[model samples]
Target: MKITYRFLLFFFSCAAFFHPIKNAVAQENWPIKPITMIIPFPPGGVADTVGRPVADALSRSLGQPVIVENRAGAGGGIGMAAVAKAKPDGYTILLALSSISIIPEADKILGKPPSYSLSQLKPIARFTADPTVLVVRSDSPWQNYYQFIDAMRKSPGKYNFGSSGNYGTMHVPMEMLKASQKFFMVHIPYTGAGPAIVGLLGGQVDAVATGPSSIVQYIKAGRVRALAHWGEGRLASLPDVPSFKEMGVPIQFAQWAGLFVPAGTSDFITNKLREASKVASNDEKVRLIINTAGSPIQYLDAPEFKAYWDADAKQMEEAVKKIGKVE
Candidate 1:
């Protein structure tokens, strides 16, 4: 009986010791299977333009396929909410935009329950920063930023500006412009950047506020002419077009794309993802693809991304307060 008791105790002790070791090994071997990158916008949008390339790079680095899944709806809330509630195992990740920081505050302004809190996400890295540009049809009467502003001021509500959706990244920036400039134009909100740009091309809207990637092709094709970019300086691709600051608008905003995992994800997994993202961000092919999309490849690691995200969140919160609700 004594020998049997000793044997049982030893067995339990060994099992207890090995259990945590097994878990550690499992975590160390993270991403043994495929990973899914959730892009909260339709294909051909900024997220898709950046996410797909990053996903490809990650796949090569991790030795596993990283699939990009588009879950476009609710101005990016639906897809973001899904990632927020997903298991914190680093398998399911988010390729998020500036709207992720804006939508939560917009929801509060609209008196809706929060879809996802900033705390629910852990920023892995930031890959791109593309400034927003306001563009008009090439055939429009307004030839430059001054002309467009003058026309809008003279005829309030005569021109209409289209965006991705209500209270989205594109919408909020336009709202800020209106508030600052005291110009009035009908706000036209579309489902995503693709449709919003389509609206502009189809003559459904007077102008569109979007990232360079979404409309660079149209701008090059002479289908649309950029009036102003919301950046501190001119874009290399559109050097002649002045920035909002140059025009005395005092607006500088860019739609940044980054990788995120659910909150509470293990540090080990997060570090692994961060390392993989660093590799992907520096990949020559990935950089080429992102540059071709018209968004500069600006990489920030996890710690830096977290700080940037916090600052961006605060800025968006204040902007939302000034713009009030979309309705």
Candidate 2:
């Protein structure tokens, strides 16, 4: 009987001892297969634009192809929830917008079970935080920012705007404008920003308040007009555009893209990916793609990004509270 008990004790001891070694080996051999980076918004939006470049850069650094999948919906909730529940094996990651902070808070306000919690994800890096611009078709009657707001006030629900989703990054900023400035537009929600932009261009919707990455190309092509932005000063690239602060609109908002992994992912894997992100964001090709789109790279490592994420989440919650249960 003593021999059996000793045997059991020895077995347990070896099991504990080898468990970490097994994990270490697994983490070290990670990306033996391709890694997937999920962009919560569809193609052509800020998330996709930033995500693709980052993915390309990361693939070069990690020696494995980093594939991007667009899982767009629910103000990015569909993709965000998928990544949150994904195996914490580091093969899956989220490249989401600041809307990453909004969806869970919005679910609370809507009295629904949250699709996922902020605690379910860990920040990996922040790639870009660019000011949002308000745009209309170039031929639209409103010639300037002041004229645009004055028209919205006069027309109210007669005019319309489209957004990525109900409480999406794009929608929240417009809602902020509506609440703060005492105006209203018939709000139209699309599955993602790419579709929202399509709606705007097809004349299905009249305006879009969106990240410059999503619209600067269109502006340069003269397909859209940029009357005002949610910044205190003009963008270096779009000098002719006016800012909300300069116009006394009393509201400001910016769209940011950041990376996240599921909680409880092995620390080794997290650090590996984080290091890859640092290298990717600094790559000259990545920098040029982002800068040409009018959002210069604004990279932050994990710890600093978490600090920024926390504060932004708080601000989004407060603003949502004031807006309150938009139907």
Judging by TM-score against the true structure, name the best candidate: 2
- Give the number of colliding residue pairs in candidate 2: 0
Give Cα-based local distance difference scores for all models. 0.90, 0.90
> The CA-based lDDT of model 2 is what?
0.90
Instruction: List the lowest-lDDT window of 10 residues for candidate 1.
Output: 287-296
Per-residue alpha-carbon lDDT of candidate 2 for residues 115-154, written as tens digits (9 for 90 to 100): 9999999999999998889999988998897788898899
Against the true structure, candidate 1 has what lDDT?
A: 0.90
Q: Which stretches of model 2 miss by more than 4 angstroms? A: 1-13
> Model 1 over residues 1-327: C-alpha lDDT tens digits?
357988999999999999999988988888799999999888878888889989999999888899999999988889999999999988899998999998888888899999999899999999988789999999999999889999999999988988888888789889989988999999988878888888999999999888887888899999999999998887877888899898788887889999999998999999888999999999999888878767878899999989998998899889888988778
* Pairs of residues at least 3 apart in sequence or in different chains that clash in candidate 2: none
Question: TM-scores of all models?
Answer: 0.94, 0.95
For candidate 2, the TM-score is 0.95
lDDT leader:
2
What RMSD does model 1 have?
2.4
> Number of clashes in every candidate structure?
0, 0
